[model samples]
Target: MTDLVIRNATVVTCDPAGTVIADGGVAVRDGRIEQVAASVELEAAAAGARRLVDGKGHILMPGLINTHCHAGDSLFRGLVEDLPLEPWLQTVWKAEGAILNPETCYLGSVLGFAELLLSGVTTVMDMFWYPEETVRAARTVGMRVSTGGIFFDPPGVTGDNLKGRIAAAERFFEMFSDAEDVFPAVLPHGAYTVAPENLKTAKQLAERHGALFSTHAAETRAEQADVTGRYGRSVIRHLDDLGLLDERTLLAHCVHLDDEEIQILARTGATAVHNPVSNLKLASGFARVPEMLAAGVRVTLGTDGAISGNDLDMWMALRLAATLHKAVTGKADAVSTAQALAMMTSAGAEALGAAGRIGSLEAGKLADMILIDVKRPHAVPMFDPVTHLVYSTARSDVRHVFLSGEQVVRDGALTRHAIGQTIEAVERLKPRIAASIA
Candidate 1:
């Protein structure tokens, strides 16, 4: 018997073949996709369904994947404003985020996860401090996450100061490596924040465990010029020299990568996560997605942080990525709707090393999906569902979200757990908001 069934929906698998199963029904059992076919076929295939959801006039697709973010900064959503990366990091954000307690980080992760689930994001690649808090929050919310545990020396550690950070990561891995939905990774902050030697240590430890090593590289022109000035190589090349750029490395915000750097990323099979809203808001450069895609690089989408993006909205990231690619390249045929959908879905899953598990609406994959209200006004004149999702529809239109075949969101409201208390707790934190802003 199927645990739950969704009937009469336009199913977009976003599979490699770009399959769109129109007039389809989904059979889910034990938190996995059992079958996807016409309603009659689904009914016959699963004779007994504990619960069946009528998906008439709805679009069913894989849940969105937000591949990179700072879940530790949710409380500071609007604190860092009207400043570039240097000033924002040097002044407002760094000072604030660097001091977040485990409790604050937990609250922030919970809030961020809630927002992502509301916007149909089933998977997240979160890089932050106090990750045990993030893991606990993920468990509570029942959201899948790739945890990029921070491994950097404190403000001033001169020589070979990696033991403490590495120990922390090892402990994290040991604790949560067997977790059902948590994937632990080693994350060095960025080229500027972390020294070359520390990057090498992080790479070694990450490679030792075949774990994902994430970092912010080549985010701005200043960051770009400084790296090249010091090493006579691009930022990506420098990381490569440290043995950091590999299939196990996830480089976020490769906005200033040159053509050769793009080639290196493609050659190394490393993943790139483009943070368009954060880049735009911070006045950071747009990642060369057209060139990156042309070079066969696997690119995914991310919402950097609520502090930078002003909201934990992956839908905004998807729309910004599609439009930003076109606006910058001045070509209408750039970053196809299908490809954009892939980036937010299967490509992100692949980046997190969970390709066949959650990114696509396929049989045997974990049943993480969302039902879009196709009848909405902005979603009208329904020429192409992909384009509508990318260009027209807002995050508010997410009517339902599912994780592991369970209805986490129903009728545009969270149903898996009680979120009102979390929201209220965040609101109560208003007393401390002044300190962050100050």
Candidate 2:
């Protein structure tokens, strides 16, 4: 018997051919998708399902993949604002240094993951301090997370220095070697905070253990100039020189790249995560997403952090990405609805090196998906499902969420934690967090 079956939904299968089923059904067994067909076809196939869901008036699609974020900073949302990357980082880092511990990190992650689940995000790639605590929080909430055991000089939470950081990552990999939901990576902060030698070491460790390596790059003009002054090259070129640019590398905020730098990213096969909302909120320049996609570069979507994005809402990122590029390039066809959807789904899966897994609703892939209520005021008069999904849908439309065949969200409420208690817990920490900064 199958674990769960969802039937009678508008299934937007983000497959290679972009198939959309009017009345589709998906069966899940052993945490993997068993079948995807019309409801009439799957009725008998999933006749013995342990759980059956009526997905009427819902848009079913793959769970949104958040390619990059600093999830532990959720508690610091709006704490320090209206500043660019440099000053913003300075203040946020201080707040992190003052009160960051395993417990606080867990609380912040729980807060962030809960928000993500409500917004239809199931998988996230987080680069932050105290990642062990973050891992624990994700597990508790049953969210899929690909995060690094991060390190920096004058380390933030995990260790003291680069050496200490590598040791901690090794231990983390060992501890979570068989983890089904958590994928461990080796993440250095960036070229600005970490030396070239440390970046190389981190990449090598990631390669040795077969994990992901990621960091921020070219988020601002000041960052580019600093890297050029220090190394006589841009950050991308410098990382390439250090042998850190590869298929495994995921760069966040490639917002200020020139033509040559964009070519370098394409040639290196590195993935760039476009954070349009965060970039705009921070007054960072626009990323050349249109050019990147045209050059055959794999581009994905990210929400950066709740502090920068004001919320971990992928719908904002998707809608802004789909619409903002048109205004920037003065062409209405700049980033298509299909392209924007791909960036969060199939393209995101490819970027995270999980193309065979959770980004699509294929038969063998993991059953990570969300059901959005489409019989709402904003989503009414639906012409194209993809267009409505990209342009009109809101995060509040998410009705149900599944991770590995298990229902983590049902009817806009979290199944793992009490919403009132979660909010109250964070409210209790408000005084201590504020006093630390004071």
Candidate 3:
């Protein structure tokens, strides 16, 4: 018998052709999509399905993919505010030093991943101090995560030296080498915080493991100036000079890139992840998203972290991504709705090198999808489902979510884990978190 069947809904395939079925659903067997067809076409399968979900009054689409985030930093939401990237990070690090440990990191990651999973983000590329804890939290919340050891020059949260950091990164690869849900990566904090040789070492580890190398790059003018002063080149150029730009590289926040840098990214096939909410909140300048997209740079989306964004809301990210550039560039269509949506879906999966497994609704792909309720007042009279998702849908509209054919979230609540305990735990630590910077 089929494992599960969901019928009677609007299916937004998010495929290259952008196929949408007006009244259709999907069949899942052995944790993979068996078929995606009209409700009428799925009747025979539904008859013998182990479980059937009637997705009436909903739009089913592929789950969102967050290409960049610090999930554990959710513990510091709204703690250090009204500062730019440089000073802001210093305060943030001070707080992290005081309160972050493996246990707390896991707690905070659970809090953050709960928010992401509840809002239809099935996969996330998160950077945090405790990558094992990050993976633990993702598993507890029943979501996919891409994370590994962190690389920082100074004694950060883990306080590991260069040799210790290398060992930790390699150990991470060994631990999760077979984990289907964990995508291993080596995350150096940024060019400003990590030495050039350390950055190269991190890249080497990633290359050796065939994992991703992610770091903050040119998120602000100060960062660009600092990197250029240190290396005599801008952030992207410095990375290229070190031979670190490639298809496996995930660069967060190319907000201050020049025209030549944009060309370099396109030529190297590195993905640039845009965190609009955090960039705006921290007063970082707008990313040249339109120029990058036009240059054929594979652009993706991220929430950054709740610490900077004040929340992990990919819908807000999606809406801002779809609309923000238009206002900045003085063009009504600077970024199209589909392009913005792709940044969180296909582009994200591509960035993680999991394009064939996730990202869109298709036969033989993992059953990672979400159902958005269109019964809301704002979602009514939807002309285009994609437009509605981009401009109208809210996180609260995500009523059901499936990861690998398992019902991780049902009726807007997590099924694998209860979040009330996590909330209470964070609330207890709120005072300590506030006092860290004080």
The model with the greatest TM-score is 3
Question: How does each model score on lDDT?
Answer: 0.83, 0.89, 0.94
The residue-level lDDT of candidate 1 at 249 comes to: 79
> Which tens-of-lDDT digit does each residue in 362-434 have in candidate 3?
9999999999999989988988999999999999999999999999999999999989999999999999988
Query: Under the 3 Å rule for N, CA and C atoms, how many clashes does model 1 have?
Result: 0
User: How big is the positional error of residue 278 in model 2, measured in Å on the Cα after superposition?
Assistant: 1.1
Quote the lDDT for 375 in model 3.
Answer: 92
- Model 3 TM-score, 2 decimals: 0.99
By summed lDDT, which 10 consecutive residues of candidate 2 come out lowest?
151-160
Q: Single out the weakest 10-residue window by summed lDDT for candidate 1.
A: 152-161
Model 2 lDDT tens row, 323-382: 999999999999989999999999988988898998889999999999999999898898
Which scores better on TM-score, 1 or 3? 3
Show pairs that collide, candidate 2. Answer: none
Off by over 4 Å in 1: 93-99, 155-161
Residues 306-389 of candidate 1 have per-residue lDDT tens digits of 988889888888888887889899998788888888888999988878886889988899999899898877777787777778
lDDT, candidate 3, at 75: 93
Candidate 3 regions off by >4 Å?
A: none
